[model samples]
Structure formats: structure tokens, C-alpha cells
Target: MKNHQNPRRTFLKNAALSGALATLTSGVSLASSPSKRAVRRDFNLNYAPHFGMFKNHAGDDFVDQINFMAEQGFPALEDNGLMKRSLDDQKRIGAALEKNGMTMGVFVIDPGFNWKVALTTGKEEYKEAFVKECEKAVEVAKIVNAKWMTVVPGYFERNLPLDQQTAHIIDAYRMGAEVFEPHGLTMVMEPLSDNPHLYLRHSNQAYMICKAVDSPAVKILYDIYHMQRNEGNLIANMELCWEEIAYIQIGDNPGRKEPGTGEINYQNVFKWIDEKGFKGISGMEHGNASPGKEGEQALINAYHKADSFK
Candidate 1:
């Protein structure tokens, strides 16, 4: 049986999908040369790397990167901008992940999500857009064989009180939950710390929102980098939101790069998640600290070091 939802759409929305895939098949090596691996080894958990993270080693071909990740023992992948890619690319990547036994992690539900409109405004237009995006996310998830889609509830409304804004966000997410629950897809709410104006900035707030939504379809992303910046109690805050947390994303703070390049103690964090028996993907949603093959290898080595915890 074949799924026909997005088999061939040139793309009706604006996302980084095209930009990511446009260079996928270019065959350009970001490093001095392409990487050639002699063996494949499995990591401890399903830690997912994004598309261009290994372009130096894998070349610019997206499928080749997929192969390289598998060859390097990567068990999963996360594409934050995947929803913007073409349907063909989505299918190909999905097929590749399936063949390599790699899990597909979170991708943005809507590329138009970063705008200033508030879901907390109780505005019908904003709520409608959120619901539509949720519906589209279901279709996109089918194409990529993805179980999780990332969601941002939008910025805080300046005119609305904090409590009112929270309620509106909850109401909008409840509608989103209704759309996603039947498909068994989860919309993981991400509390970003990139800027101060954003609405959701803490794990506790996301946890409360998830509780308000009260559905398996809605959960928290629990990005380590953002949480570490927003608040210092990483382990405790995560434990508090543990029940509502559906996925995890990684980046060492001070620098949103791979494990060893910054202030985070990823080994401890990875070990903690491992001990907790989390069977979900930990998205490597950060940049390479070093450039070219050296950087890519460093990134890989960093993960290896972090995973060495027993």
C-alpha cells in the first residue's frame, strides 16, 4: 500500500525545506574531500543529526549523508526544516531512514511559525492557522515516517495578561490535539530561549500547557540548550516535566554546537536519559564547532565520547 497525501506537491508553503534539499544532490564536498568510512558502529541511543552536519564526510547528496549516518552507526535523524522540502525528497529520505533502521525525529510543523502573531490572543485567525498547520503536519509526518512535529505557540500578546494568553494558547493547542491525536502523531511544544520575547521559555510552562491540553498528541520538546539558558536546573526541571516530555534536542550552551565545544556535560545528560529508559530520539539541533571534515569528525567523536558513559 502507498500513501498518496503529498506524493507530488511542488510545495504550497514557505519553509527551509527547499534550501536544505536544493544542495542535497549537488555532490559538493564541504571538506577537503568526501569521507570514506571503514566500519559501522552503533551508538547507545537514537541520537539524531541534522542534514548538513556531515556534508564534508557525506558529501552534499542527501541520500549519501543518510547512508553515511547509518554507516557511522547513527540510529536516527532530525530535520527542523523538513516540512519545507519537496515531496519526493521527503519520500526518499523516509525510505532511506526505514531501510537503515534510523528513526525520524522532529521537524517544524510550519515554517511560518516564527512570526509575531499570538495564539494567546484568542484570535480566530491565529487559531485557524495553527489548526491548519496541525493538519498539514499530519500529512507531512506520514511522508517522512515521522512521529513527532515541533510546534511554537507564538509570541506573547502585549495587550493580554499572562494568564489570558496562557488560556488562549491552551485552547489553540487543544484544537491542534484534536487534529493530531487520531493520527497518532505528536506535536511537541518547544520552549525556545533564542530571544526574550517568545511566549514559551521554560520546561515548566510547557509542562503546564501539555497538562492543560491533556492529550497524547501534545507534549514538550525539552530542548537542553534553551532550557540551560533560560534556567539552570537542567536535571530537576526535566524531571518535573518528564511525564509531558516527548522528545529531546541537544546543543552545548555558551555555544550551540556539538557536545564537547561548550559548557554542557552531555555525557551525564545522555546517561541520565538512558537510565530513565527514554526510547525517543535526542535531536542534534546545533551547528558544527569546527569546519569541514575535522569538524564533522569532531562532532562524531564528541557523540562517541558522550555515549561512553555506562
Candidate 2:
């Protein structure tokens, strides 16, 4: 039977067996070798992830976290409480960021805000204090090579007239702008939506303040999460204040988690911003939906999907 078999059939059977053997060998080789490290993909936007967002995957060490973020191609970082971190830690983080070629995002300049007299009351001491904080922010910015710092005008003063309060806030920002203007640093105003007591809660409000300040050093942070809560028309509001918008922060509404875990259509928003040629960083200022490494990976995947928009 073998002698009578056709040459074509024999060749075909041999070829099939050889191909299977080669595939099996390749599988074995791959399985035996150490798994290749994942290559970082270039994201469409400079999405700034805060420290500790990837702690589960990268550990609690700041340098490790920064390295992990770089490995995953996160081009920038924003830490609202960066000034509160120890000077040594700040230096270490700055070094890590520099080594990884990452951009430093916004850090909170005034942690002691939220007082009635801070910026709205027009108190001389309060204004001086805000300006002093701006000075300190300049020093911190020098350390981290940061260009933007977040400034919250603080709570509303019930005793003061609304117009007077607005004027005071504007004056305070103008004074604050003086400190960083020489250093080529910007203080991006953040409008909070947590409570009615807090002042500067809308994009238009921030836009007006930025206009009043009339300096490149004073611009709006344009936090999407808070804006979505305070005013539902995100894209329109974004466009209204597009010119003065220096930086952007991102968090989905209902739950301040990653994009896909909430109601915000981040794909459209990202696409719109990209189409507009926005060269600023969008800080991922939200929490993860789940816990541990799996959740961190999910958050990364969510951004990849959102940024896939053409």
C-alpha cells in the first residue's frame, strides 16, 4: 500500500505533519522562554495619571509608580496634594519623571483654601496669604519642573455682596499671577462643585475670572467632572472658554472613577479636544472602579478604548 500510494498524497501528508510539528515547537519555545515585557503604546493624548493610581500594579513606591506610568506611556502626571509631599519625596519624584521623559502636571498651590476670607472676602491678609502660597508654588514648580499649579478661590462669603466677592477673587488672582508671571508659570483656576458654599463653581465664572486677570499666567483648569455636575452642557461650556483653558482634569460623574465606569462619553470628548488641537494634558483625577492590579489594568484599557476615536 505504501509503494502504490500517490506521490502527491504522500507529500501533502508529510507537509501537514511538518507544519504541526513546527507550530508545536514554536509554542514550546515561547512557553519555556520568559514572557516578553509589554511594550508601551503611544496614546493619542497626554493623559496625566496621578501617583498611586497604579499602586497595585507598580507598588507603593513613588519612583516605581512613575516608572510604571512611563512604561505604560502616560506622558504626564498631576498630583493635587503634591506640595504636601515631603521635599525629599518631591525631589525623588521629579528625578523619576525627568528620567522617564514625563511632563509634570498641576499641583495644588493653596491647600489652606476653603476659608471664608481666602479670596472672596477681599481681606488684605487673605489676599497676601494667597499670594504667599503662589510664591511657595513657584518654588515647588521649580523643583518638579511644573508649569501649572491649581488655585481654588475658596468658599463664598455670605456677608459680602456677590459682585464684591467676584471682584475680590479676581484681584487676588491678579496679584497671585504677579508672583509666577516672571517665572513663566501658570495658576490654573479650578471650579469645585462639591457644595454651594464654595465659590468658582462654573466654567463661565472661571472664564470671566481668567479674562479679568488678563494674564497668560492665570487660566482655567476646566475640570470635566465638576463641570458635569454643576453644568451639564460640557462641550458647549468647554468651547465657550476654550481660549483661556490651560489644563484639563477628568473624572466621570455619578462615580468619580475611570471613564467607562461612568456616564460620560469620554471618547467623544477626547475626540473633540484632539480635533481642536488641544496640546494640554488631561489629568486622570479619578479613582478606579475595582481594586488591585486588575482594576488598574482596566483603567488603562478604558483610556485606550476612549482614545481610539478617529
Candidate 3:
């Protein structure tokens, strides 16, 4: 009896091996082979990798992870829960970034992912509380040498009219803007597609609020994953909201993983972004598609594939 065959799987493994071997021999920047590190080179776009993306390869230490990202050619780092980190940790990460010459990308305005008081409720108290959080964010930003911070306007209130909710969001953000403006920092509001209850969920909606606030400190965080789920016309909508977009995040839909794991053609998207002369960060806001060190390598490979869309 003939042995069972897995030709497709075998072919994929062989192809990956070939790519790794080629990258190893070439004295050029590319995803590192598991046994050897890739030569560090400047990527066309400043792609930012988030914490835990390379943990298997870099180990559990935060600074080690950052150093690994820099070694792998990632020029920036973004952390979603940076506010939760202690002051010492923040300073440590900052020094590490300085050491690596890596730019600090967006961290959430506050570590609290959910708000007890919705910003869209049109309440003065909630607005005040959010403004205070923005103040805290400024100090955190200063410690980390960060310029952009992520903002989520909070839950959608069914009892209130859409206009009222938008108005409330604008009011709160304007106040938040005042806090960040003096420090030359930006509060980039992210529109999520995770639930129907999210107040900010579309590029145009964020654009509208930003225009009303009319502050340099307030802008849109065009997260490709959520936007892709909310609306399919990724490039067109991004183009429409281009000016208001200050920071960008990446996650492929169907699974909030690396770029090539799902429907988003990140290559074309990245190519378009590069053409527009965007000097800001394109954050890797997604999880690794696979597990362990192999998964980390795959994430690096995905970015290389996406970044090659020139």
C-alpha cells in the first residue's frame, strides 16, 4: 500500500524554506529565517509592530521585544495598553525606543478599554472625566516620546438621536483636544466595527466629528480591519478621509490577524499609502495568524509581502 501523501502541505513548506534560504544569502532587508536574522534595512513605510507580536522570538521582556522589532526592520512600536504600564516601565520602553531609534506610535488615551460613562451620552460629567483622561495621556506621552494617541468616543446611545450623540462626542473630543494641543500631541479617534453599540464606526463619521472640532490635535485613526468590516470600499473611503487621518492600524478581517491572512489586499493598500507620502505610522494592530516563533516569523513575512507593493 502506498503511503498517504500531503503534497500541497509539502509544497508550501518547501516554498517557505526556499524563501528563507534566499533571504539568508542576500545581504538585504527581509523577514529573518528562523535560524538566522534578516538584514535590517529601511522599509518604504514606517510599519509599527505592537507588543507580543514577536514575543516567541524576542522572549517575554518588553525591551527585548522592541530590540527584536528594530532588528527585524520595524521602525516603530505601538502599544494599546500603555497607560496601564507603570511610569518606570513607560520610561524604560521610551529609553529602549531611543536606543533602537524607533518611533513611538499610538497608545490608547487610557488603559480602560470600556468606559462606565459613555462619551456619546451628551453629559457634562462624562465629558469632564474624558478630558482628565486626556490630561493623563499627555504625561504618559511625554514619558514615552509619543506623538499620537488612540481615542474611542464610547458607546452609542439608543435613547439619543444620532446627531446628539455626535454632538456630544465632538464636545468631549474638543475638550480632549485642548489638553493634548499644548503638548503637540494628537488624539486619533478610532472607528470600530466590533459592535453596533460603538458610537464611532465609520471613516465619514469620524471625519465629520474631526471637521467640527477643527483642531489640529484631533484626527481620525483609520484602522483598516474595523473599517474593512464596516465598509468594503477600503481605498475609496480612505481616500475620502485622507486628510483627517493622522494614524493608521492594520488587521485583516474574518480574523483579526496579520495582513495576508484574510481579505485585505494590504499590498495595494500599503502601496497607495506610500504614494500619498504619508510619514506617519502604520501600526500592526492585529494578532499573529499562527502560533509560537513560527507565527512571529509569518507576521514578519506578511509585512514584507505587504510592503513590497511598490
Candidate 4:
């Protein structure tokens, strides 16, 4: 019952498995090739990328990544989590963007979850917290020369009437707008996909809130990815809410990845936006379906392909 394999045979079998694994991994690496040069395209405004997108090829350094993005012809960058970065890091990133001729896109001043506290509750403490955040956001905007910050109205208060909740959001946004107006900064409210419990979950809902806020500082951040998932008629909805939209974000639906990897006809979508004469940056807020440098190249290629629909 204690039969054992010969020593030489065992070694050979282990070696074979190790070699097979190495071969499989190498094949994957080759298939996911990296870009040899930055992608170049003819488009209006700038297509923004967040940090870590090019880290593998650019060596985990923000400056190098910015240089790579610039080389690829991207003229803008966005960081939703930029406020979490250290002050020195923010300054360095800002400098890199400037040196690369890139503009900063929207960064979070009061991402919906925290900012919504004031809008939903109307408690003085929460209102004070939100105002303080707005004050800090303005300072950060000045540091980076950022023009826009993303905002959200938070969860739907089940106990409150819908009209009452809407009124509360308006008050909170008006307060935020006042804080940003003096500094020439804008607060962009984003509508999330239908999750039932979420308060601000549609472009029309956001458009209405923007109207109620009644300030130029309050505008919409139209994220096509979320909208496609929430509402089907993309072009029509965008056109309808065009007046209040200040910025846009892009990602293919089903899988929040690059353009060509999903069902969204990004080429037509981009063309429509361009035809509409949008001047704001379209934040590339998705991930690559593939991995590593080659995947990155594919992502750039996809954008180029979609953007070439002129």
C-alpha cells in the first residue's frame, strides 16, 4: 500500500509542470503587449486618465506616467481620489500635468457618500462639515488649477417625502455653490445607476437638481458608463440635459473597461459629443480588459478607433 514514485520520474514531472506554467504565463504576457509610443488622436478638449494606468510601463512613478500619457497624446488627466493624496504629491502631479501640456480634469471635492450627509439630513453639523470640505476643495483647486470637482447628493431618505428630499439637496448645493463661486470653481453632480436606494440616479434627476440649485457653479458630470447601465437612450438623454452638463466621463457598459471591449458604440458616441461642440474633457474612468503594457496599447488603440469616426 506504500508504493512510491521513482525519484528521477518525480523530478521530471515537477519540471514539466513548472515549464508549462512558465510558457503559459509568457504567452499571456506577449498577447497583452504594451504601447511603443503614446497614442495620438485628433479630438476636441482632452481625454483624461487617472494615475496607475501606465504604472507598469512607466515604472510606478507619477511623473513618468504623466510623461507617457503626454507622449501618447493625451492632453488631460482626472483623479477622483486626488484629495486623498498628500499635498506634496498633489503639487508634483500638478507640475507634471502642466509640463506635459495636460489640463487637470474633475477631482472629488465632496464625493456623494460624504457630501450627501448634509443634503439628506440638513443637520447643522453636517452642513458645517460640507462647507468646510468645500473650502478645502477650493484651496486644492487653486493648488492644481483644477476647474471642476465632483459631487453627489447621497442616498434617498426613505422617511422623507421626495419633494422634501429634493428641497434639502437644493439647499445643500446652494451652500456649496456659494463656497466655490468666489474661487471660480465648479461642483459637478453625478447621477449614479439605478440602485433603488440611491437618491440621485439619473441624468434628468441631476439636471433638475442643477436647475434648482440655480448657480453656475453647480453643473452635471455626465458619466456615460453609469447612464448606459441606468438609462438606455444615451444620445437623446444627453441632448436633453445638455444645458446643465459641465463635464463627461466614459467607459463601456457591462464591464467598466476600455472602449472596444464592450457593447457601447463609442465611435458614434464620441462623434455625437464632438458634433455637439462639447468643450469639456471626457474622463476615461474605466479599466483595461487586458493586462500590462500591451493591454494599455490596446486601450489606446480602442480610443483612437472610436475617436476616428469623424
Q: Which candidate is the best by lDDT?
A: 2
C-alpha TM-scores of all predictions:
0.86, 0.86, 0.85, 0.84
Question: After aligning candidate 4 to the native by TM-score, how far in Å is the CA of 19 from where it should be?
Answer: 59
Write down the RMSD of all candidates, one decimal each: 9.9, 19.6, 15.1, 20.8
Q: Is candidate 1 or candidate 4 better by TM-score?
A: 1
**Candidate 2 positional error at 288, Å:** 0.5
Task: For model 1, name the residue pairs that clash.
Answer: 17-84, 17-85
Give candidate 3 misplaced runs (Cα > 4 Å): 1-40, 111-117
C-alpha lDDT of residue 98 in model 1: 60
What is model 2's C-alpha RMSD?
19.6
What lDDT score goes with residue 166 in model 1? 96
lDDT of 4 at 25: 26
* Distance from true location, Cα of 158 in model 3, Å: 1.6
Which residue pairs overlap in candidate 2's backbone? none
User: Which residue segments of model 4 deviate by more than 4 Å?
Assistant: 1-42, 111-118
Q: lDDT of all predictions, in order shown?
A: 0.80, 0.81, 0.81, 0.77
- lDDT preference between candidates 1 and 2, better one: 2
What is the Cα-based lDDT of residue 34 in candidate 2? 38
lDDT of 2 at 245: 89
lDDT of 2 by residue, 24-122 (tens): 122112233233223243687779998889998889899999889979888778888888999999998887766666778899886375575578889
For model 2, the local distance difference test gives 0.81
